[model samples]
Target chain A: MNQRDPLKRVLYIDLSRKSFWIDDRVDLFERWLGGIGVAVQLFKEEAPKNIEPLSPENPVIFSIGPLTSLYPLASKTVALFKSPLTGNLGESHAGGRSAIAIRLAGYGAIIIKGASQLPLYLVIKEGEVEFRDGSALWGISNANTVGRILREAAIGRGIRTIMRIGKAGEKLVSYAAVITETYRHFGRLGLGAVLGSKKVKGIIIYGKHSIPIQDKKKYREIYDRLYRLAVGSDAMKRYHDLGTAINILPLNYIGALPTRNLNSSRFEGAEEICGENIAEKKLARRVACAHCPIACIHIASIREPYPDEPYFYKTTFISYDHELLYSLGSMLGVKKIDDVLRLIDTVEAMGLDAISTGVCLAWATEAYKRGIITINETLVELDWGNIDNYIQVIKYIVEQPNDFYGMLARGTREASKHYGGQEFALNFGGNEMPGYHTGYGAIIGYSIGSRHSHLDCAGYRVDQTIKEPPSPEEFVELLIKEEEWRQILNSLTICLFARSIYNVENIIEALKPLGYNYTEEELKKTGEEIYFEKQKLKLKLGFKPEELKIPSRVFETPTPHGLLKREYIEEALQHYIKLIEYKTLQ
Target chain B: MYVSSHEVKRLAILDAERCVGCQLCMFACSRRFGDGGLAKSAILVRSVGGIERGLTVIVCRACLDPPCARVCPTDALKLRKHGGVFLDQTKCIGCRNCVEACDIGAVFWDYETNKPIICVHCGYCSQFCHYKVLGVEKTI
Candidate 1:
């Protein structure tokens, strides 16, 4: 009860015994600064390097940063675990009431360990933790339906976070994700499968306590300034109106939108499922995380008559984004918005990652055409923009009906290896490729990023400079530097979209009002340290950048700039390995 | 500067569709009285169910010749000429009279003070509404 607002209070949940306890570890919060910073330290301390990601020994750590719930845009929560798919350090970030609720619940982080005997849900309110029976809610198809049930069952409606797994999670799909608050997600590296392995159906957390501020006047001043800037800014307005789906047309036109298993960089029918189209034709609503001014999550309501019966109609509310549009729309040759929406809905209902699911399907389609997977053996024929087939295929992936579905559910790389099509696997570091097909930077970023993610290094953000390309050595160093600093922001749990507003200086100033004291240099150093710790974990887990396979199909396809030679990519990756090794030595 | 209930004034109105649930109005209301949090806030911004369902902007609608002030148990709730009812937090016991009397349900209760807090239509929230969701006008 005497704990400071931001200091670390660790909530430990033991699923095997159905017991939980809170332990205050002020040192953890004080030194690492919470979120990924604390999570990496904890991951190193608790989870062994040799443990299987889906095993009971693998610990799931969810942490929020010091600035979370204290600043306007610092509303993200970081979830860290060993990836079920990648077999390396796994981390995912999500926004919603998750961060705010975790902070307000008076805990810096929640550490979940040991698999349960039966389906269960953990409900945390204020300082009390309750283990609720979730047998009735197990194996639910729709992720949002769980939200409604949790909303009614839990105490907090407007203030709490409801994070749940769907059918894909229940079936232990390695690429499944944990969906929170209907739209937000612990999106990558199979966190949902981890939760499913432990039989945790959902976690609902809520708290209502006033936090202490360093200076009330100063806090109010900074809060007001950030609030005004966030609400009135043109950047935020764009996000509010069209959302991230706006990136579709521009990325497609610029030849960076990743079409047809990433063999082609342009999609001819990009406009049909673009952000503008979604906004004008199908956008039913927009939602935001707790305290976020920019509500970018777009939900579309589409009504159609039943296939068997004309009299009865089925109305489905599906969420859309540029990444999914690229992966499912253009990549799968899905020109019709309704087809793409249905495909996305199927993925969401099963709780599989839309990007990974689409890319996996894309790889399967290519593999099928090449006779690697035959129509007789498959549940559905893999084809472009075939919603009916896509729906059946997703269900099969979730169910892991046969050897092919089981391998495909693991990810494209494993599936490709099993089916003999490594040339078009479309995976980097065992994870499916994100929707960025920009040159060297994105490729190098995915190869070396601590989390093997697009947002980790944001190499695509500086795609323009990669036209001429940098020397292999220079590129790796620059990528490391950028990724390290980004670790700092993500640890702070700040939304990346607000990067312009909450620059290092602004972040420091903003944190001062909330009782944090650190110079920009110190913060950056902390971030670098955190990033290196994650690298150490990956190295211990037998990760070798030298061994990563760059799909051969990329070399044959000439991009907008020119043909991307395979040797250049190899050289860059070699440089990456050397840089990481050099950093480790230092 | 002492504007009483008899002084000539105006009222505030809000278009709910324009509200982004920024909670700026709640902050502005609490700030005017020199406090923070939902406890002191008069205007409330709560989502109808989820964020995708939009928001419900709850505040005093300022009924023509108010009934909340007239039905006050201990003469604590008073009619402000600017619009709506104002409560003298120190004057009344926590009786649930004015709460039921109002049709629009604008009378907000503060748990800490054990008193009803009503919007006075001073329109301080407009300063914080960067989206221009609120409008304040004078009645001739």
Candidate 2:
């Protein structure tokens, strides 16, 4: 920790008091290494236990890392606050201009506490912050247009970050996401709703200041070496070529695509939704982060003909990813490219999480079939690859007209409980399942991983490697190591796909140019310490493994390998919990 | 290999309709400065809405007879024949006159240096533009 970067200055803004102050907790940044590490420490300090997530007492903590603006793919800014959805630790990371802007604006972190009486947006320039009225932007249904208006009004167009929530957040939907730069998002655990609770419409920030480097010459040398690897690597090639949608065919071929609410693992029309298909037929262009050479963001154009008007038409561009394809495409039985695009657009317009939205719709569809929620009670029919009806359902998820739809807005777990379809709720830790259906690693990782995210542990890779299912102990051990290493990667704030080209030694070398003096061993230990700290914070905040609910639907359907027994998953979860605890002790 | 000035240089123009707002060009531009951060970069990339609607990339187009240099109060902005304006930070004041003069708003200001950070069109940012979103073709 002696050779660590200077502590980032913390900016605390109290909406209730309409005041702001700075806190330079150097020790916290040096000890934890920023992002989740610092955020967790700050979260425990600011947001005490038993406070309502949407209350004035709750604090929303936004954090970035030391490597931000100094390294490629280290563009994600992590948000940590109590969840409006799970009533637990709600953390989401987004890549856009957010991380670079926050770092350049001269702060490592910002904590917003209390609630404003009226809707407002905060603008941070240089070292000063301003509170502006957002009455005009209030209740805007379209999230995409909001970003454009803010962009036009801001001093820095490309360099600044404009984070705003749409109707879903304004409505206080538990799955609402904070949209940044349009394409990137802090998409899960309802950070949008948390912002809405504070009556905060948006955050606009931009700055141009140099980050003090320890060794200028060495920093340049090391940075160039890693930069070349990131921009030129084979792993990054596909991302640049087609983005994340490329995983569709490969994942589908492996029988891990999760089609039709887990009833089948493979989608018959998987090729149509693959990255290659989108790139060839629909892909308009590729995009990247402020300091990232990996332009992995893919935008697709969907031109639709008017039903009645002649020669009058509108073209809508939509973003595609593996999760969106799995949830809205395969899970909902959507096959047509246009249909999938429309569904994704609807989700974004409503300011909802596409993965969760798709999963919720899937659950409702199955529930309707089982005589749970009647046809009249639901707004739209849940048919696979049905774009028009799915769009209507997405709108309802945000608006939540009747009691049934309102209950469903809370997420799959809450919706399933009320409607008696807990068996196939398709959620872990209150967040809906991601696209992966690889095996034990994916399930166990979702069940026990900190964020209940595929990225948290990425156990799917482990499952893909094993021909025979590993024993419960073996599976648990593999996930533990994966999660531990990932903790290090996240702390470094680099994208996980660069794991092949950049190892611990390479990362240390990369930082040497920036003037960080840490050996490979030191880096590993640092990663381990940060990982344990996050777990401890989660546990202290009341995260319990025994209390996790496993949806019954997964057990009934046979995955690609074979039928998944309830006992196997339970056994794996039990071992995984113990392993996590054991690692924390170490 | 000599090129004439009369022909238009087929530089990669960003069709905002196709943009995903990824900002990869921003990082590529920052890399040209041989530094790690967005502070020194000339290019800008940002999202429209959750990526589906696309992104916007902002950089100097190297305008012919650049207005940034013409309106400079302190002779800080200098126009080059090829395109773009070279900014002399030492001679300049932080007046932002050139920023207002340039119709495209390509004249960027570095807050820390209190000077304009215009694009030099060094072609290094093009190396990272693997998508071919940026092209550095010669004018005939």
Candidate 3:
């Protein structure tokens, strides 16, 4: 074990006792190599089998890699928990001050368990942990306001991370996000709701511990090489230019946009609300994570006038990314860019996962139009592209004013279960599907993924670009291979944006200077092991890989590639099921 | 007390208007000392309140009188020829007098070694500030 790094400290906090303890888990660090690797292992150890996700027994783990502060683009923190949305293994990664702050704070991972009796906001500076009373902050109107309060109260202003939940999390909106640094988040799988259930409102991590290096010259050489690759690479520039929102126009152009309940693949108003127009018209600023040179976090400034005052206006900052655009802008049939920004802003303030929230509202609107859901149930006339009504409905979802909102707050899958819209529920596995409806890979990836997330496999990238459609067996193989490799990325917890630059050759080289000497084959084997561990967690929970569902809407609508035959999806999913099932025995 | 302001090179925050708050300059500062991480950083960047407003870069202002030097009981915070001060670790008693002395919060403390970390005016951090929020200048 390369115990050269003293930063491999695991901090455990028990909310029921309101006590914290630190342990040196260098063994886990050496095996898993940190980030998702360490987080999933901690989660499996602490989270009891067959325990409900929202219960006190569930564990929330945050882990960053040993290569985190030592390298550029190693700027993501892996968050693992049991999913309240999918009722299975939950994994989410976030970048900002989060990864660097946690790594510098002298910890490889943090495992928090047990529910608190009272509302609590954890304050962690360097090593000391203080459980601050968050009674005043609970049920705050906006998530931003909670961040503003913690930003001032916490020490180490320049180099710190503040992760807080908003009204949605407070109400336990099933897909509520644990927002970090205002813009970034552990955005999927209801990590925030798990925290809310524990009566924990927010967490602040501050640290500035010096890292010791064995070989200084080698460290500089690797750092310079990676940094140059990041800045010089055209792939990275795409993120800097338009961020992930760059995908909107291209995906729309390809007729795979998933517009308006995915009844149509192409969005007619894509030109008006696409990345180019937004970057040209409304881009307020671009920000980066601590070590990342690529400033992909794009903010838009939208000015709206007061109702009464002729000239009085309020300028609001709304963060935009590919997922938010697809979910709110196209999926909801929003035409105006400002309207999309407004919806994005509403979800951000409410602390909801914009993707799931948008999909839920889309289904609700379709269900209402089809007479499945009545006006009394919705409390409003839910319509397509109706921004004003959508705003009110989002508020209702967060507030959970009635039985309908409460059911919808659980997620699209749960909502569609009670109502008669399972066909158009548009959920892959139990989690609501992301923007892509491209091909077999995208469909199977979402349904079969451990996290039920697009980031897990990124099969959409393959589905959209490949010249020939991959066969059902080939498609399942693509997902399996990609998921395994992604385990490596998530473990290193490098930003997905820099995946191309940090190839296997570079990853093996990068690990050397950080005192983690490993061969390429060994790294591949590690990824394989990490993938099975996540699969084990999923199988241990209620998720059956064979029981994965193919939502009817995906087949009903034709993507740019063509109408996806039910046989193709079923065959591909079967192949994946067999693959995972065989792994359990070994 | 005679205020000594000598002619020498120093790093200064030029304009924070365009700062994106990457904190790469701080990484560069720590790297200059043959290590990684912000424990030994001489410069710092933070949001004014929320990140939407941009960032404020806090480095050695190269103070005219140098309050950090005046409060140093063991002369650890040596008054440099420039506006800032140089920290001599051997002389530092780790009492943290200089950390409290700087009203601008330029003095960063290293809890590991129990000493105040001051800027050496090497200008390494300024080179990495892509936004040019920081610059190296001659202060007489």
Clash number for each model: 0, 29, 1
CAPRI class of candidate 3: medium
Per-residue CA lDDT of model 2 for A1-586, tens digit only, reads 3233333689999999888988878878777777887888898899657588788887999988778887667777889988877777888888878888888788889999999999999998766889988888888889987876777776765568889999899888988999887777889888889999999989998876666666666766666677788867888887777778888998898888888888888898888878888888988766676677777877789888899999878898777788888898899888888888888898888888888989998988888887888877796666666677778878887888988888888998888888888888899989899998887778888887888888888877777877788887777767767777777666656667677766877877766666557877777777667767777777776788788988876766655556667788899888868866787667
Look at candidate 3 and tell me the lDDT of residue A28.
90
Interface root mean square deviation per prediction: 3.2, 3.7, 0.9
Q: What are the DockQ scores of the candidates, in order?
A: 0.25, 0.38, 0.70
Candidate 3: share of reference interface contacts reproduced:
0.77
Q: Write the per-residue lDDT of candidate 3 for residues A304-374, one digit (tens) a residue.
A: 99999899999998899888988998999998999999999999999999999999989999999999999
Tell me model 3's lDDT, rounded to 2 decimals. 0.86
Give the per-residue lDDT of model 2 (tens digit) for B9-126.
4345545454444455565565555554566767666444334445566678777777888888889887665666677768898898888987765666666577777877666666
Against the true structure, what is each candidate's TM-score?
Answer: 0.91, 0.91, 0.96
- Determine which window of 10 residues in candidate 3 chain A has minimal summed lDDT: A1-10
Model 3 TM: 0.96
